[model samples]
Target: MTPKEYFKQAYRLDKRIDSQVVKLGELRALAGCAQTISYEEKIGSPNRNTEAPFVKVLEKVYLLENHINEQIDKFVDLKYQMADAIETLPNVDLGLVLDYRYLQGMTWEKIAEVMNADVRTIYRWHTKALQLVQMPENPIII
Candidate 1:
C-alpha cells in the first residue's frame, strides 16, 4: 500500500476512535444516571421492598458501563498508535485537513469559508493533501 493511503486510513481510524470515545462518554453518563435513579428508588422504598429489583437493574447497568469503558480504552489506545504513525511523516497539511474535515465534521463549503478560500481551492487542497501523504519525500504543497 502507498504511504499516503496508509496515512489516510490511519486518519480515518483516528476519527472512528474519536467517535467511539464520545459514545463511551454518553454511555457512562447514562449508566451513572441509571445508578443514581436506582439508588433513589431503593432509598425511598422503605422495608427494603425494592431491594431485589434495584439490585438486578443496577447489576445490568454496571455491566453495560464496564463494556463501554473497555471499548473506550481500546479506542483511545488505537488513537495514540495512529497518531504516532502519522507523526513520522513531515506533511502537516494532510493532518490539518483530516482534522478539520473528519474530526470536526465540517463540510467542504464550511472549511472553505473558515480558510477564506474558494470551495474549489479547498477541494484542491484536500486532494493534494491526500496525494502528499502518499509520498512525503516529494510533496506538492497546495
Candidate 2:
C-alpha cells in the first residue's frame, strides 16, 4: 500500500476504535438499565420473568465488551507497527509529520500548529514523508 493509504488505514482504525468505545459505553448503560427492579409489582405476578431477559442482556453485553476489547488491541498493535515504520525514516521532520498524521490522527493544520511550522511547510513535509515511508513486505497481522 502507498504511504497515504497506510496512514489512512491508521486513521480509519482510530475511528473504528472510537466508535467501538462508544458502543461499549452504550452497552454498559443498557446493562445498567436492565438491572432496574420494580418494588411495587403485584404478588404472584410475572415479575420473576424479568430475570431471564436481564441475564440474556448481560450475557450479550459481556460478549460485546470482549469483542470490542479485542478490536482495540488489534488496532493499537497496528498503530504501534505504523509508528515503528515511521521511525525508520531518516528525517526527524518527516517522522514527526507522519507520526502526527497517522499515529495521532492529526490534521495538517494541527500538525503544523504542534510542530510550530507553516501549514505549507507541513504539506511539503507530508509529501516527503510519504516518499520516505517504508512499508513492510508482509502487512502487520491484526
Candidate 3:
C-alpha cells in the first residue's frame, strides 16, 4: 500500500477503537445499573433468578473491555511504526506534518494553525511527507 493508505489505516483503527470504547462504556453502565438495589427495594421485589442475567452481562462487559484494550495496544504499536517511518524523512517540516495529521489525529487546519503556516502549506507538507515515508517489508496491519 502507498504511504497515504498506510497512514489512513491508523486513522481507521483509531476510529474503531473509539467506537469500541463507547460500547464498552455503555456495557459498563448497564452492568452498574444491574448491580444497584437498596435493601427496601430488594425486600419489596420478588425473589427471582436475577443473578444469572447480571452475571452474563458482567461477563460480556469484561470480554468487551479486554478486546478494546487489545485493539488500543495494536493502534499504539501501529502509530509507533508510522512515527518511525515519518522520522526517516529528511525534512523536519514533513515529519511534523505527518505526526500532527496521523499520529496526533489533528485536522489540516489545526496543523496549519499550530505550525503557523497556511492551510495550503500544510497540504503541501502532507504531500511531501507521504512521498518521503518508507514502510517496512511487512506493513502494519490495521
Local distance difference test scores for all models: 0.57, 0.80, 0.85
| TM-score of every candidate | 0.50, 0.80, 0.83
The sequence of per-residue lDDT tens digits that candidate 2 reaches over residues 1-142 is 6768766776677677788778878877776774555588566766556455557767877887888788778787788788888889999999999888888778888999999999999999999989978987666643
Residue 137 in candidate 2, Cα distance off native in Å: 2.1
lDDT of 3 by residue, 1-142 (tens): 8888888888899889889888888888887774556566444457666565578878998899889889888888888888888889999999999999888889989999999999999999899878877876777776
Residues 57-111 of candidate 1: C-alpha lDDT, one tens digit per residue: 5566567667657655654554445455445546665566555664455788888
Model 2 per-residue lDDT at 102: 81
Which pairs clash inside model 2? Answer: none
The runs of at least 3 residues in candidate 3 whose Cα sits more than 4 Å from the true structure, single-residue gaps closed, are 34-51
Two-way lDDT contest, 2 vs 3, winner:
3
> What lDDT score is found at residue 8 in candidate 1?
46
Poorest lDDT segment (10 consecutive residues) of candidate 2: 45-54
